[model samples]
Target: MTVSVRALRPGNRSDAEAFARIRMLALPYVFFTADSVEHLTARLHPDAHFTALLAEDDGEAIGTAQLSLAHESPEPGQALLNVHVRPDRTGRGAGTALVQAGEELLAGLGAHKVFSWVLDEPADRVFAERRGYRPGSTAQFLLLDLAKAELPPVPAPPPGVELRTAADFADDPRPLFELDAECTADEPGDVDHRLGDYGAWLEETWRHPLLRHDLTTVAVADGRPVAFTAVRTDGGVRYGTGMTGTARAHRGRGLAKLVKADSLHRARAAGFTEAHTGNDAGNEPMLAVNRWLGYRVCAREVQHVRELG
Candidate 1:
């Protein structure tokens, strides 16, 4: 069977659905859908140079790749590529073909390094090592069975602070965006981030199809958002925490925990039976909050880096 890779068709519902299906089949823990796929392709910053590629065997898609330059990072020449093949279709060359195509795109963009997430599985690790990729920091994908797990009571905000949903800022979300930028800059990750572009944030995040604004809890202190936990729904029973963070000044106040708990409660009440989130291994504070909320690590994936010569 001839394996070929090509860019996902813009504005095509079929291609978007196929891409999302292959991705979800390969990695079900992350939140994604046809709408989410289209959103990524349409809303990404132009500087990001993002491209979604589909891998096919004789014209039938079997894998997907999302590759882009780390445009928002302080560092330069760094690119990201994540390739996932359908679990049932793995013995073929589709994965390798997709990876080669993705790397070619990144390298052509003048990227010096390519970082990819490799699942914590024997076959997955060997696949990367054979391709010259070296494993780096690991991340844990946690899952909470909201229907059966006991969720903690939402913490009461301290005096002068109150908890509200993202919907509360319906007319204006800049405060939430500001808080998100501040917390994102300090987030634990391999690539340092810069969220200085409000326009990009509004398109890529605020209008994202999966973001459940009404279920996303925000901590307001004196009329400003100091902490927040954003929620993403699968249009069904699953909900995922997109990000949870507190303003640097508000650290150690359990605001992260407070916001996350409230978001979870709202998600459960809204009929989402399963919840998912991921944390960098070194992020102890957020991990602790997840544990307190009864989320258990369901899978682990390591970031693998390969330098382009």
Candidate 2:
């Protein structure tokens, strides 16, 4: 069967849903929905040059590829192209077509490098290797069964620190933004990101559709956020921590664990049955924290990098 790739139409419900379905089938650990797809595509910074490509086979959507310039990276001409094909549709030409289309788009944008995250499976690694992508860092996806696992009790905050929900700063979330920026700069990753764009942060992270501010927990010190566990809910029974980190000065005091525990307890009490999070394979600290929280590693993915011609 012949496969062709085309740009996904924003605001088209069918397109969004089909993209979401493909993503869920290929990478169940990550969170995605039609609403999130639409929101992200519509709210991307103008400089991002982002596009969602769908691979169709005989009038049926069977794969997806998200291609974009790393507009927030300090390095110029860096691009990202993550392709995922439906499990049932593997071995078809869809994956190859999607990759070809994505590369063309990135090359047209003058990208000097392209990165992709592929599941750490034999076939997936082979597919990337055959196309000149070299394996980079690996990350683990974790799952915690809120209904069955035994979660550690929320710990008491240190004397000077106070626990609060992200909702507490509804009037002004600049403190949280500052903390997020600090943490993001220090996160273990292959790319160096420049998150100094406050306006873009407000649009991309603060106002995102899946961000559950009410369930997100923050640790405050001296009236400023020192640590936080950002939450994303599917409006169902699943909740995921989008990012959990502590300010560098406040590290080693276990504030991240405290806020994450609080968030998990609150989420379960509010009827969330499953919780998910991801950690870089090199990040032993966060991995330990997740283990202490009863999260078990469910899957692993490897990043592949290629220098564009």
Off by over 4 Å in 1: none
- RMSD, each candidate, Å? 0.8, 0.8
- What C-alpha lDDT values do all the predictions have? 0.93, 0.92
Provide the TM-score for each candidate, comma-separated.
0.98, 0.99
Q: Estimate the overall C-alpha local distance difference test score of candidate 2.
A: 0.92
Clashing pairs in 1: none
lDDT of 2 at 40: 77
Q: For model 1, how big is the CA root-mean-square deviation?
A: 0.8
